[model samples]
Target: MTDAPLSGLPLPGLPLPGPLLPGPLVDDAWLAARLDDPRLVVLDATALLPSPGHDGDYSSGSGHAQWAERHIPGSRHADLTGELSDHEAPYHFAVPAPEALAAALQRLGVRDGSEVVAYDSGGGIWAARLWWMLRAISVPAAVLDGGLQAWEAAGRPVLGEQEEPAPAAAGPLTPVPLPHAWAALPDVDAVLRGERPGTLVCALPESGFDGSAPTRYSRRGHIPGSLNLPGRGLLDEAGRFLPRAELAARVGAVLDDAASPVVLYCGGGISAAGAALALTLLGRDDVTLYDGSLEEWSADPARPLVQQG
Candidate 1:
């Protein structure tokens, strides 16, 4: 009876290719059909951290290098940190400047109206981030449901060699992007500020009070008044998301009980996006992210922390 939360919105939602905008997520098979199509744009959104000590097994760089080495055969690279982030905010991979994003996509063969798909090897963290930004600006885009690992798991194929730039699409996207500013991130100041009057959920996992060395932070604790919600519960063994039935049950409890102004955070800003995206799929739109997260909070030297001692 009531209107669907995302019923008429043109800027965000699924892997929809509609009149006013594109979609937020897509499955692998849908993308496979148009892998090499010129009108379609496929941007690799892998984020690589330095390998722990292996022979370049699967860091983000290695993933890109691997892609160049072989991809869907013609997919272009969309560096998550560089192409999507402005680097001006404390959040490492926050959204990039609209003009910069437009130009970068153009260089990567993306033009207005081009169907875009982003993916990552690191459990969809980077992939979802890129997808979120594109949808924010009414760009037609989606995330490779399972991501690179799934692509590889399907025995699809990969490229370990460099290739030339893919051809550009016809729909040249205007730089008239939407704004996704955080209105200034929450710092140590946020913790001391007390909870907002309405509803909000803390996505941080509840750790045991037996604090050892502070693997979680510079201080080894959590923010004041935060309703601890472990992000790991949102994923399964292989690092992909849990089924919708399970996801709805878990997240719904929070939404039904916790306040509507849902705020997600992790050790840093990365994992929070995944949880938030999942919530978005569940049709809860009144959500915001505490960009600075516990890292910024603990490091500030002036914030109060509920340590597990």
Candidate 2:
């Protein structure tokens, strides 16, 4: 890739990119104002894997622990790796079939035009996964910027318990389906080919950009011609996104030279969602993620892998 300056297109001050359907993202301030609106649906996305932390704290296990105790009023739990995912897959949290996804959303009371908001304790990475899934299904959705941390910082109310309403009965929201929505996915073949420019973005840390694998990927290198603007580069110490001005400056700096057709992918497509979140904030409408990411790419014995320092 070539070095470039900050981009000035689509204006610099917008909240998110342009291709993102409406409700790409909404901040705590915005959600706080509309928290009680019946049209709005909030989701809790905090998750902890079965693994324990140094302090013995479970990571992906936190969502249920927190949600069962207290959550934003009217918010439901959105499990990216759980209810919304498939464990019987080649990979975990592989996007569910459109029919299955729509059914899942309908259970949460999401209908045509239902305003959906998702947030995780993490800086909206997992949340954006859900947001992206919703987009795939053509559902209007947004992530809670800064996630629950921002909610707490704003002193917003959280609920420990709430009435569990009867699960609703509904079907897929969209009548039109993806040409391969159920089975279609970004594969190693296409990525190794590097068919699209600017769309194939890498959120890997610049410090380790020699194409070192970041644990999740099966191989030690990244796909060829990938963009480098690590998602972690977009965060502050508290695990929240940087201020809009700084975020724009950094994102614009990266995109200034980037060609177009933005496609983002990280170790496992997690952190890249953070960059996608940032791009959406910038108002760029063209963006897609290589879902299989390096994990799928590196695992392929036939695909080519490129490294940069």
Candidate 3:
């Protein structure tokens, strides 16, 4: 909440409070070099974005099954829907309280000074969510560029046998209160009222943006005044994020200024994280995710939505 600059913490190739470096995306070569570092922690944050009429339970998703079948050697599984969220909430992907998140990371052997690298089978969609969540809590984290696909392309080995992590000892895992990392319903309302100085970005595909696609929500349109920048487009043919200049060009069109705040939302909040990460890589740090997204927005009849087709 405070405008104070973030403390200088060393990220992979960048330091906080200074100019952002290339990105938080870690390639297989970089990860391979640090694989045996005692302070390093690898997490398979695989998850399936739910579709219309699909079961909302993340436990039933293919993420866990895939982790069981094959995963990066020594990487632990982090359940986005199960242990990382408040399942009782009305919508999915609701960010958990700091204590709850700390406990979950602790269980996965994460602690202070542990540099976390998250990867998933589905490019970095699921992994970016976990990375954003960790950074929201002020933890040093990065996403595996192109995720499992990139790892395989680099000839990295994945193990079929699961390896359990040793229990983490107690240490300082304090979470700095960063209110700007998340956007609540009131924030969206402020955006709608033109009282906020920011842009609203819809991270869903064009079908959903244009109201032509069927959805599970009560309504089938997009938030009024939102700009469409599908999460899928954040990556290229190889599933890696576009080069910095290219990323800046794509997102710069809708954003008035590089430093202006932007609120990102998708069906839930999963893909929104990808959008947020892309923005971060472009040096637009004033980004937040609308956790409830369409699930809450569309269900509210009073909320305004602009439809097309």
Candidate 4:
């Protein structure tokens, strides 16, 4: 939105084709039916969340290698690490500026009127990050239910090429910031200082939250008083989000009110989107992601962290 493409006309084309699905999580059946909508664009927003041994390894050439192996036929890839994230930022996967985001999206063949469906091989974490970014800019987008694994499991055909879509025509992409949807470093500081009213929820696994597992950040443990709700808890074995009632129940056990103000964070802010997306599906639109997350917080010795023995 900050970076609006110069032209208002639609770009000439894409190899695959939409209007998006009605909900945030579209299924194999739903996507398979409408693969030819001109206004529809499918993006494989796949990126491996960094592990202790693989921290900051996107530069080593493995990210693109995995993408080239298999993906939805005719789908374009959105690189969360290299092209899409804010490389200038100190953190590894910081969200790009509105201008940067708008430009990258245009290159990926997203028009002002395009409906986007994002999916990833790492469940939906990477996909949800893209979806959340679009939502932050007030753009309409959705995540594929269960991602590529589900599609493959259902015997769907896959394309091995890792090609990008034709550049879309320029359009007025006014990024309307959704205030409630994003929580930055300052917000987390405010929470730590007791000037903000909200719950801090770490969407990382229990080991990550408890500082018992290998970490990729500058420090171990979590923000003081944060609860552990591993992102996997929000999804089933097939990697699709859980049913609404069940989802609400699992999350509600921690924060009962659907309207409760909660700030979600995980390492580098990726898994946080998974939690944010799950909360969105449960009709809890009050949640936000700490953009810098632990990557920013832990690096500063002045910021307090809580660790378990």
The segments of candidate 4 whose C-alpha lies over 4 angstroms from its true place after superposition are 1-19, 53-62, 165-172, 257-259
Model 3 C-alpha lDDT versus the unseen true structure: 0.80
Q: Give the Å shift of residue 124 in candidate 2.
A: 1.5
Model 2 C-alpha lDDT per residue in residues 1-309, reported as the tens digit of each score = 111222223556775333222457666777776665545667777665442223223234336766767677778887776667755656655666677777777887776646678888766678877777776676667887778888888898877774644433343466235332221234434543665334456786874345432344445556676668889788887667688789999988878777666777765566777787788777876777767666556666677767653
**TM-score of each model, paired residue for residue:** 0.75, 0.77, 0.87, 0.88
Q: How accurate locally is residue 3 in candidate 4, as Cα lDDT from 0 to 100?
A: 20
C-alpha lDDT of all candidate models, in order = 0.61, 0.65, 0.80, 0.79
Superposed model 3: Cα runs more than 4 Å off? 1-23, 53-62, 167-172, 256-259
Q: Point to the candidate with the largest TM-score.
A: 4
Prediction 1 global C-alpha lDDT: 0.61
List model 4 lDDT by residue over 1-309, tens digit each.
Answer: 012122233456833323345767778877776666666688888876556763222221225556688888768888887778887998887788887888788878876777788998988888999999988887788898899999999999988875654645666566677777778888887877788888899998888898887677778889997887788889999999998888988987877742248899998788899998888887776788988988889889888888884
Ranking of models by lDDT: 3, 4, 2, 1
Worst 10 residues of 1 by lDDT: 1-10
Q: What is the lDDT of residue 176 in candidate 4?
A: 70
Worst 10 residues of 3 by lDDT: 1-10
Clashes of each: 18, 26, 0, 6
Give the alpha carbon lDDT tens digit for every residue of 206-237 in model 1: 55222232334556666665665556577777
